[model samples]
Target: MNGAVQAGYAPPTGPDRPAPGRRWLRWLLAATVAWAVLLAVLTWVSVRDDPPTVREQRNLAEAGPVVDRAVGELLAAAGDGGAARLVPDALRRGCRITPFADGATLTRGVEVLLADDDVRGLLQRVADRLPAEWRAGVRVTGEGPVLRADAGEFVAVQGRSAGPGRVRLTADTGCRPIGAGYRAPTAGGGSEAETATELLRRFGGAEGPVQVSAAPCPDGTTARTATAVSAPSRPDRPSLPGTLSQFSDGALHVSATDELYAYRSSSTVVAERADGRVRLTVSTVCRR
Candidate 1:
């Protein structure tokens, strides 16, 4: 009976005993832990040293100071001859946020209403006067020669000819969610405002639309500018350039031509007459 084996046989507790999927279960557990560890490592690698996810957000208001600083520096570099005014918002309906999301972008800048016909030279002067890190350079285009540079911090600065005697410089912050709209800084008429007004009166020009612009400087100071245009006016002497030449009381003559005049004393004052309109622009550094 002992030699006649049973239909099925099994070992009780010995080396010959089956572990019953114990090894498979242990392998499965090990594989699961390894996969989890790999996932954790990948995640850590991706987000290491990254800033808190805040949309890299900058609204028009937040970006105004940056643009103003750039514009101020640009005006300073362009000498005291060109008439400059700040364009707080240049992007109109075209201000789109991004390709992957819904948002808006704001661009701010200064427009040179009066400039030398030598656009190339004017652009070159501005390019050289700016911070060397800006990598400013002039490139030729069909419309005219243009100046472009990276003003650091993702701010793109560019200068181009707008018309026969017009040039514009801009610092653009590509795109961001319109966190907040721009609120222009409150500014009063600086001391130069009176001078600008006096010059206008000397030319028999009546004050028209006036725009005041302000920007922050790198030294924790603010630069301010005031611009006024006239309505078909003429000087007592009948010659715009000649009338300006006689104003040598305290201002240093910057430039004088048939259609334009510039003087700089404590502030830069520019007068340009074209198409029966006289435009006056005044700029001062660190006024506020």
Candidate 2:
């Protein structure tokens, strides 16, 4: 038996070994899978814990009845006694009210159209009606006269011009959110101006240059405005420019040039077409 060997039989040595390349590939595949899983978990955590965006806050404020009720209460209070004499019928009829929230602050504003002189009188009336606590801070002057009163912590009353014949009266109350510190969710888009330019180039079919500029608001936010003129594809069928309606339903990732802070909000689009030329303007607010 030792002298005779079975046909095609060889002496056994050790267990079979995988080639080096195969081993390396296996390790690489495992690493990739682990990395992907880790990334998914982090993303889930981020989204779950992220604070609501400013736009979301604004939407909530707009939809909620609290602001409306506040406005109604203020109006009712003003209408009481002889206050009705101070507010004109036309002003009352044209009144518009909006309530919004910024961070922990809740703001409700009422706007009315009136003559320049009427605005002064209305402000005076409002000042007189404000609570005693707000009276001391109340100041009135010419050149866009404003009446402001500090009610309490992060709460105040304001009266200013919405435009030439428009006056806006607003009240703000701040109630900071309690508990864990909030972190603003990252805005997904790059530069808002760049995004606007790209969208215009892709859709506008412009014949000349596009202009983009940044305008800072009194609030800390910045507004990026992009303008372009598009040539008509055909003489009879003029080009229709961009519009907010186009992007209102879509989630946009926008950022600022200076701060590079990004946010996800719908880009405000405005478009006009005339005389075989389409004028498109896109603007979006970027949080610093």
Candidate 3:
């Protein structure tokens, strides 16, 4: 070894070609495990931080019974048979009361069998009494009346007569932070039918003049009916039902009784074959 060291070079005594392929494989396995751990951590964080959807927050299943109880209590307090009976019917028609950070909203389809005056009276009573019972604040603004209460913070209530008998009641009852403002989900404005439905839900009846007609039924009964239409003010523009449009193409058909009592209302979509034009129609119908 001393002679070799003193010479030009020493002979190979140990394996020094390169590290085994297994060493690189082991490093790769370790790196892969680290990457997987990082991904799992990131996924966990995302899931934990993500917020719930509006529908989830509403939790109809959990809130339905609560709302039912509240409404029942209110009805019991009112002792008004007309209002008491109608609320249950409205609830059965997929009506719901969903809570938010500031308050809760109540929505229901309306098809009342009672007189219009009675329905209006009942609604007024509800608007008047609910806030008092909940100890909520009431504020009448340009948009309409609003009710506010303290759930976790300040909650509010706002709603309207969706249609002739349909009602939409909103209350602020959420715990989360509110941004700009809260706007409840409404029907989309895609087709004439959709627009008509939304118009009825928003305003209940058409603002234009309604047409009346009568036809004899096969059962020897007279069928009295009322119809109304809303059309685009200009040919280039589209029209919506209710008082918003001028062309008078939006149309509605309802029973004469409904027209008289103002109990039931509807929205319809009509398509003209000649020009392939679509329009919305809103109508009110009376029940037998």
lDDT of 1 by residue, 1-288 (tens): 866757697545567754868778989999999999999998787668543243244555566566667766786776454555555455544445666656555577766655356778788888988889889999999978999987654668989987876778888767655566655566664665566677677666555646777776555655677777776765444566777767655666545775777666666667777777777777775321
Clashes of 3: 34
Candidate 3, residues 104-147: lDDT per residue as tens digits?
Answer: 33332212222243444544554565535466444556745433
Question: Once model 2 is optimally superposed onto the true structure by TM-score, how far is the C-alpha of residue 266 displaced, in angstroms?
Answer: 38
Runs in model 1 lying further than 4 Å from the true structure: 1-57, 80-94, 98-105, 111-116, 164-166, 203-209, 232-238, 249-258, 285-288
For candidate 3, the TM-score is: 0.26
Off by over 4 Å in 3: 1-60, 74-128, 131-133, 147-159, 163-288
For model 2, the stretches where C-alpha displacement exceeds 4 angstroms are 1-73, 77-104, 136-138, 141-143, 178-288
TM-score of each: 0.65, 0.29, 0.26
Residue 39 local lDDT, model 1: 97
Better of 1 and 2 by lDDT: 1
Q: Each model's C-alpha lDDT?
A: 0.68, 0.45, 0.35
State the displacement of the C-alpha of residue 9, model 2, in Å, after optimal TM-score superposition. 86
